[model samples]
Each structure stands twice: as C-alpha cells, then as structure tokens.
Target: MAAAAGPATLPAVVEELLSEMAAAVRDGAPISDEHLLSLKFVFGSSAIQALDLADRQSITLISSPSGRCIYQVLGSSGKTYMCLASCHYCSCPAFAFSVLQTGDNLLCKHLLAVYLSQAMRTCQQLSVSDKQLTDMLLIERTQEA
Candidate 1:
C-alpha cells in the first residue's frame, strides 16, 4: 500500500475499529461480516492489537500440537505479515510508522484482523502476541504449502 496515503488514523478503541475495516476494503480485501467475527474474541480487548483491523494474512498454530494453543499470522490480502516472534511486531507496512508517534502500540489494520478472522484457537489461553493474534484471524487457505 506504499505510494498510497497511509491508513487513516483510526483510534484503537473498539468503536473506531471500523475505520480500519474500511481501510481493508480500500486495501482490496472487502472484509465480510463473517470475516470480521473470525477473531473469536471471548473477552473484549481494551485496544485491538491486530485482529481488530485486518484478517491475519496466514496462520500457523505454533503452540498447539492439536493446533489449539498458539497460532501465527503469516500474511493478509496477499501481503505477508513477517511477524518476528522476538520483538512482538508484525512486518506489515502499517506498523513501519506510527501516525501519532506517541502510543506504545501502533494499531494497524492487520492487527485488527487478528481478532476478526475465522481460523482461531478453539481452546482458551492467556495473553497472545500481535503475530499470534494475526494467526487467530486468518481464513483457511486451500492452497498447500
């Protein structure tokens, strides 16, 4: 999405999350309500880390042998989210810069999708990382790796 104006400044609160959803539509994903609810949120997060914005591009359930505990977000809308497990971040272009330059977290649309996509952890656990959140929101891909 470079060479384009950055994602609109969407405050991370639950109410403004739709702006990021709208951003995804602009970005070309055309998120459906079914896609939106895929995040499988049990208790609402105060601020959406990833799934609240864009669907986790790709998901690998890293922590789950049964594939239930942990999931990883690989990419979205053909954009690969290279989320390094170390720094707690996603390689999504949106997180490269912060619009406000003040918040501890830059709420990008990809992060929003982490909570909105369908392929989620059916089991419950504690806190999850941003990339893991991305995994939670990913739609299952038919193509094999």
Candidate 2:
C-alpha cells in the first residue's frame, strides 16, 4: 500500500499547482484539466462560488497609495466584508475558523476570490474613507443588520 502524504506535502502541492495555473493564465494558455481538477479538489465548492462571484465583479479590492491590498466581498446576504491579503485574514467567520484557528492554508472565499481576481489581473479598486474603514471593522465584529 502507498504511504499517506505528510502534513506539509498537501500545502506545497496546492501552492505549486496554483502557481502553475496562474502562470498558464498569465501566458494565455489553456489551463490543463489536471490543474482545474486540483483546484476544485483543494478549494472545494465555496471557493468555486467565490471564483464565480469574482469573475462577475462582485468582489472589490482596494489598493491604497501606501501599497495595502484590502478587499471587499459582497456576500449573498447583501453585506460586504473586508479581506486583508497581506495578513491572510478576512472579516468573516469562515476565515476565522477555517484559516486562522484551524491553521488551514485554504483560506476563506473572500481571500480566494481576491487571489483569483489578482491572478486573472481583473482586480478593481474602491475608495473608502477612514471613517468608513472604522465602520466596516465595527460592523464586521457586530454583524449589524
């Protein structure tokens, strides 16, 4: 019988595959079936939905003049949450549990969406005032209606 992969193996494999996919996309090459299958298997259904939303321009990423990469994801609930790519963090519960606490590198949908958007070179920007940033953070914690 074949031995199972070690803990570090999976992340490394996923990283390599994602990099290959990104490179193929940048080169305008048709992505291979193996790459697509690897992506689907690694990221699962939620990430696919996030990618679709990103393709539809539902995810908005903001880049400050200071070189900060912040993202805003509009969820199906009609609410927006922030994503910090530099920190590998998001203002959503899925990120908290799936990425942070569990230490899973897979990341939340918002993060995945931002990644796909950046890889495809279709990321957009939105201007948010400092006050809005504060409000957004507050709302993320409280989830106010």
Candidate 3:
C-alpha cells in the first residue's frame, strides 16, 4: 500500500502560485482568473483584503537606480507600512504578532497586498537615487526610534 501524503507547506504553495503569476508576466500574458482564485482559496480573507488594497492603488514600489526596491503600503487605518517583499518582511503590528511572534500566519495582509499588487502590475512605481533611498530608510528608522 502507498503511504498517504500530507498537505503542502504554506511557503511551497505560495511560491508555486507566485511563480505561475510571474511566468504569465514574463510571457506578456495576463494572469488568469484561476490563478487569482487559487490565491484566494489558499490565503482566505487575507487574499481578498490584499486584492482590495491593490485595487485601491495603495501600494507603492520605491526603487533606486542601484536596483534596490521597497514597498510602501497605505493601510486602511491611514498608517504607512514598509515592506520588503524579497525578505518577506513588513513593518506592521500584525506581522509582528501574527506572522513572527505567534506564527499563526505565513504573511501579513500588507505583504500579501504587495505581492498581489506586483503580480497584477497595479503598484505605483517611484524611482529615486540611492542616496535618497538611504535617507528615506534612515528617516523611517529615526521615526520608529
């Protein structure tokens, strides 16, 4: 008899879905509705909220000429959160509590928003100099301190 298989890991499932969206973008084709549905099915309410945030144009991609990129999301509470998609980091309380501290969720809604915005090509893009990017980061850190 064959052994039963367990459920797919969250990271693996997310990576696979994102890879499909990325491939669609690379091929100059629109992401299929099925793909978005899959995201909703996997991520649940967070996916819907993320889609709403992305549709509202609340996510910004700030990139420097040197190839560093960061995401800024205007949350529903009118607060801004910085997100690093590459590292799966979001400067949000929910991220700290739910994602990191409790480990109840794989990602916060803000990070999901960033990912959804990027995949849908809906994010507002800003290009800044490397020095400006550094200054922005410094200012943000100073404010947090």
- Candidate 3: list runs displaced more than 4 Å: 1-10, 22-34
- List runs of model 2 lying over 4 Å from the truth: 1-10, 102-105, 127-145
Clashes of each: 22, 0, 0
The TM-score of predicted model 3 comes to: 0.80
Off by over 4 Å in 1: 1-57, 64-71, 74-77, 82-88, 99-106, 118-145
| Local accuracy by lDDT, each model | 0.42, 0.72, 0.87
lDDT at 27, model 1: 69
Candidate 2 per-residue lDDT over residues 3-72, each given as its tens digit? 8854432257766876787898889987688876777888888667776767877777765445444688
Q: Which pairs in model 2 have colliding backbones?
A: none
Candidate 1 per-residue lDDT, tens place, 1-145, comes to: 6586553443345434455555676566765665345323422341244452222234443443333344345443554453332233454545556423544444444444444432232212346565654564463232111
By lDDT, rank the candidates, best first. Answer: 3, 2, 1
Q: Model 3 Cα RMSD, Å?
A: 6.6
Q: Model 1, poorest ten-residue lDDT window?
A: 116-125
